[model samples]
Target: MSTPTSSSSSSIWVLSNIKLQFFARIRRFLQSKATRKRCEPSDRFDTAKNKTEPDNKVENFETVQVTEKHKEKEEEEEEEESVIMMQRTVKMLHFGSWEEKEVAVKEIEKLAKEDVKVRKLITELGVVPVLVSMAVSPVNSRRQAGLTALIHLADGTYTNKALIVEAGILSKLPNTIDLVDESTTSKLAELLLSLSSLANTQFPLASLDFLPLLRNILETGSRSFDTKQCCLGALYNLSTVLENAGPLVSSGVVPFLLEVSSVKEVSEKALATLGNLSVTLMGKKAMENSSMVPERFIEILSWEDKPKCQELSVYILMILAHQSSLQRKKMAEAGIVHVLLEVVLLGSPLAQKRAMKLLQWFKDERQTRVGPHSGPQTPRFAMGSPVNQIEAKEGKKLMKSLVKQSLHRNMEIITQRANAAGESSKLKSLIISTSSKSLPY
Candidate 1:
């Protein structure tokens, strides 16, 4: 080792030479292997493997195309079957026996539910008039079939629904809601619910025709709970149109709805319908005339679980009480102030808001009726009408007597219904303390 650097450089060059020789031998071996055309089993297998590898992507794409075509053909066949079925159904519905018509409509009902496009197609085939004709049939089975199919077809499109109505399907409804079975009543109610949407459309439907049927269902007890709800839904839909309110009130729909409003299961829809009705003059008068007006409504405000019902009850009360001294007097006489006090403390935010608003109304109403200095006043301001304290001490005693009697009666009403909101003591204290300024709101 003459020098350490020289020895290391020579060793590195020898290692590089060994690596190059190793790669050159591997290259020579691969070239020889490819050049040999020997018909060995391994050579045949390798060639076959190379040929198969490129087709995988093409095969996957071809498979997708085949699947798409198969789906299209299946759809075409289903459409063809539906067309043939509809054609046969039309023929049977028109010319066949009632039995045949029943079977045919059942098929129509099935097909209509499957596809709305098919529903439109079926109606265009004049099946609507035929179904409408079937709906008028006296045969119960035949009638239900037609109505069931019409309900589905009405669901098809807006035009189809209008056609169903224009064909006078409503007039064909049983004059009374009672049918041979609950099923018929249920289906008919459902059909009415579906058709009631037409009340607001530009299309002129006989809105009055919907009233008697809905009212009968609501009035009847044999009808199932669900069926009555359907009629209420239909009635509610009809009430949305301003013009329908007059017929609704005249049809005596208010009292039964007032009855239903007390039922918690169906209370909200019933309340909403009443709310709609209350805005109209006829509707409001009808409600105010009912004995259930503020009393039934006042009880509803105590419902801690049904906040919406509470709110609606309060809203309807507000409508009745607005500038209505008689109605406000009735509410005060019904012990509403106690219920309202409970709501102010325990009701939902929205309910609390409405309750507070109502309280203000009653407060103002009370103040106006009996101003702070107006009741049992000793001094007289000769300008205004004088029922002052000094002018009438006997009147002062009378006022005190009336107030005591009222507090006693209100306490009884509040106490009886006071299981949950039973802290009438708080309400009692407020009422007794505030008697001079305002007895209660």
Candidate 2:
């Protein structure tokens, strides 16, 4: 009786081991199939077995099998969830269709009110493409939402900037830079600032190429205030990414910036960009490429409508002073002294003081140029050489005319400042001092 029981127990053990091995092999096969299809192993296994295995098979194990209808239902639910999430994300963008400017405005207002939501969505889903689309949309709400989103994005943060780049959002920059709508243009600038705030960390070479598109935007001049401001900020940030961008700075980008610098309200930003650029060799080289930089700068100093432009111009010139004494003389020759006087005349005593100090620098020994020879009589190239003499006279006359125009403009500015004396008395006094010093007694 003992022998018969032992033999029976051994047979049972063998059968159990074989069953376990067969199931293990089946599990491995199912796992492989699931991996190939990118499906869940447990789910796919149950799915495959239910379709192939018969319900009437011998009751050998307790494995659960899922139905095909149940699997389809789960997939549909997942897809529906994804769609809802996308819709919510798009809503955060706030840009309405082209015919709906008012709706766009309202959406943007709502988005601004939902700053925390905007931040979260952007950081989580990288809604850069959505924001860019709003910028491209003709509706005011779209533009406003894009701008506000950017403002929220650029509050000196790192992760927000990373989201912008990761979304390949900069690729859309060329289109935004080319946009002509005022609201769209302004939002584009904000986008630039947001991208720039990313700095060396997130924005690398792949992202840095967008700088040239910005150069194009500034060159185009259809840009609004916000647009130009944002371009300036991006450019300032780009200056920090110098090595990979040597050609961009050298390729007339600086001249475009100098042109923008002549604008009154945005000139300070442009000057700041230039100042940032000067730190890089490529940027200094770019300045050399701008045939009219020194001259353009001088012209900025002379713009009567904007005293701040003049002040900023002077500050930038002063910074460039450390570059080379030759640079100072070159700027002086380009009419910087006269421009400073013009600024002083339009400003208060404090402005005047700043202008006078700059003017004094122009009069510095290093900045002063000695003619080939000096005498009360016009220096002749050589005796009986009328050709050189005539040319020399013409050149001198031109210089004198420029200086005279500058001096005359400065005097006029001083007169205006004196008349206003409205927060500009200091500027008025400085103008008077500079005009007096510039004119021959």
Taken over the whole model, the C-alpha lDDT of each candidate is 0.74, 0.59
- Give a tens-digit lDDT track for model 2, residues 361-440: 44433323333332022332567888776676666565556555677665655666556656455444444544244432
Regions of candidate 2 where Cα sits further than 4 Å from its true position:
1-113, 121-157, 171-187, 200-206, 240-248, 319-329, 338-357, 366-413, 422-441
- Stretch of 10 with least lDDT, candidate 1: 371-380
Query: 198, model 1: CA deviation in Å?
Result: 1.5
Best TM-score among the predictions, by candidate number: 1
Instruction: Please give the lDDT score for candidate 2.
Output: 0.59
Q: How many residue-pair clashes does candidate 2 contain?
A: 10
* Model 1 lDDT tens row, 1-441: 679889878765764465455445545654465345233434545555576566776566557556655665576566456545666776787668888988899989888888787687677666788898877788887788888899999883788899898887777666685545789889888988888877877875674666787888788887888998889888888889888888888888999999999989889999999999999999999988998888899989988889999989998988888757788889888988667766765577788787777765654442234334222112334565456434455544554555455545565555555535666665555555534234422
Candidate 1 versus truth, CA RMSD in Å, comes to 24.6
Off by over 4 Å in 1: 1-75, 369-441
TM-scores for the candidates: 0.71, 0.52
